[model samples]
Target: MRGKAVVVTGGTRGVGAGIAAAFVRAGAEVVVCARRPPEKPVEGAVFAPLDLRDPQAVRGFFEALARVDVLVNNAGGTPYRLLAQSEAERHARVLELNLTAPLTATLAAYDRLRRARGSVVMIGSVSGTRPSPGAAAYGAAKAGLENLARSMAVEWAPDIRVNTLVLGMVRTELSALHYGGEDGVEAVSRTVPAGRLADPVEVGEAAVFLASDAAAYISGASLLVHGGGERPAYLDAATVNKEE
Candidate 1:
């Protein structure tokens, strides 16, 4: 990845930061953008302030770029709010951040990406494929994101390759908050077939693969970095005795 330039949205921390670090390690000139700077700067990554929701700013950001080898749309998240707990506008906001923001960013970077024959990596979630009760809006947006990537891949073929990374639960700094506590995190981790939460660096490595020439022929693909996914709940609910 030497001499390659990569942009990672919301790359200040967490999964995004990991992705940026991985690219830096791979010798790419990585630039990380977010609305605010990270508390601790990501080593080897240049920081650029960007509000992905603002179309004008997104356009200018991309227009000023000399070249972009990869665009990783990794900025997106939602609070644990039930449908009834929030208004439609609140849900719409979530969708805008996760779905619309990527579209806006992509369109703005279209020319540069096309010129460089770049790749796009959409950070998706397993929630999109299953029932996400608390984060229904987020899941819906992610599902839409994957579909959008497929269409974009086809529309911009041979110039830009678009793909989705369907990720499972990751062990981020904020994991304890979502899983309750250490014990809760452990309990939830046990539910996954891998017996543990995925590391952010692992997701970063996968993103690197999708962006590198290693995946030259790959496009419009949904790569699962779910660590074997969750074990079927039905298996634990079975009433029949195993031993006769």
Candidate 2:
């Protein structure tokens, strides 16, 4: 990745920061953009402040760039809100951030990416493939993101490669808050066959692989970084009849 330039959206913290660090370690000139600065600087990455939702800002951000070799669309999240609990407009905001924002970013970077023959790595979630009761809008958006990438991969073709990283439960600083506490985290981890939540660094490494020449022929692929996925609920519900 030497001499390559990479942009990681929302790269100031969590999974996005990890992805930026990985690219930096890989020798790419990494830049992390967010609405605000990171709590602490991410080693070897420059910070840029920009609102992805603003079309003008998005355009300016990419237009100011000299070169772009990889675009890691990692900026997106939604609070735990049931569909029935929120208005349609609120749900629409979630979709805008997760789906529309990335689309805007991609379109903004199209010229640079096409010129450099770069790749796009979309950070997706397993929630999109299954039921996501508390975050239905987020799930729907991610599902749309994957589909959009597929179409982009075909439309852009030999110029740019687009792919999605379908991630599962990942351990981050916010894990405790979402999982209740340490014990809750452990309990949740046990539900997965891997026995633990994935580290952010692991997700970063996967993103690097997808963007690198190692995956030259890979595009429109959804790489499952889910560590064997969830164990079937039915298996735990079954009762055994034992005769003494």
Candidate 3:
């Protein structure tokens, strides 16, 4: 990855920042874009202001930037809310952020990726594989994202690779808000088979591998970084000898 140029969206903070830093650490020229500027520029990283929701803005951002050797479509999240209680517009907004934003960015970056023979690493969610009660729209969008990657891989074959990192529970700076507090985060982590939430660095490492030569032959694959996934609740019930 020494001479490769990588782009990470939503790179101002959280998992996106980690991914950008990882590429920089791996000796790649990393360019990060976000709606707001970072508090500080990552070492050896360039910041590009971008609003990925707007397709024209996304295209302009990519057009002005240098060539891309790798694209990490990592921007996305949803507010926690029950599907029934949410309005259609609200649900659509969630879908837009989690699905359409990446689509816009990917298409914008496609030409450069084709020219460079680059790869795309999409950040997916376990909620897509399982049911998400509080974040239905986010889950649905992620499920769509995975499918979209497969189609892109087929259409852009031999020139580019498209893959997904299906992430499970991850500990980020906003962990406290979503999981209550640090203690709550620990409790949630323990429920996972790995007994811990993934560190952002781990997610970044996986992205690095996907974008590097190590995954050159791998395309349209969904790599599960779920730490063995969630523990089965029925097993605990069985141990207690509970009745139906």
TM agreement with the true structure for every prediction: 0.98, 0.98, 0.96
lDDT string for model 2 (1-244, tens) is: 8889999999999999889988998999999999999998899999999999999999999999999999999999999999899899999999999999999999999999999999999999998999999999999999999999999999999999999999999999999999999999999999889999999889999999999999999999999999899888887677766344
Model 1 C-alpha lDDT per residue in residues 94-211, reported as the tens digit of each score: 9999999999999988998999999999999999999999999999999999999999999999999999999999998899999999999999999888999989899999999999
CA lDDT of every candidate: 0.95, 0.95, 0.92
* Candidate 3 lDDT by residue in tens digits, 1-244: 8989999998878888888889998999999988899986777888988888889989998898779999999999998999889789999998998899999999999999999999999999999999999999999999999999999999999999999999998888899999999899988988888889888888999999999998989999999999999877778867466675
Model 3: which ten-residue window has the lowest total lDDT? 235-244
Candidates 1 and 3: which is better by TM-score? 1
Q: Which is the better candidate, 2 or 3, if ranked by lDDT?
A: 2
Regions of model 2 farther than 4 Å from truth: 240-244
- Judge candidate 2 against the unseen true structure and give its global Cα lDDT, from 0 to 1: 0.95
Query: Backbone clashes per model, in order?
Result: 0, 0, 0
TM-score of candidate 3 on Cα atoms, chains taken together: 0.96
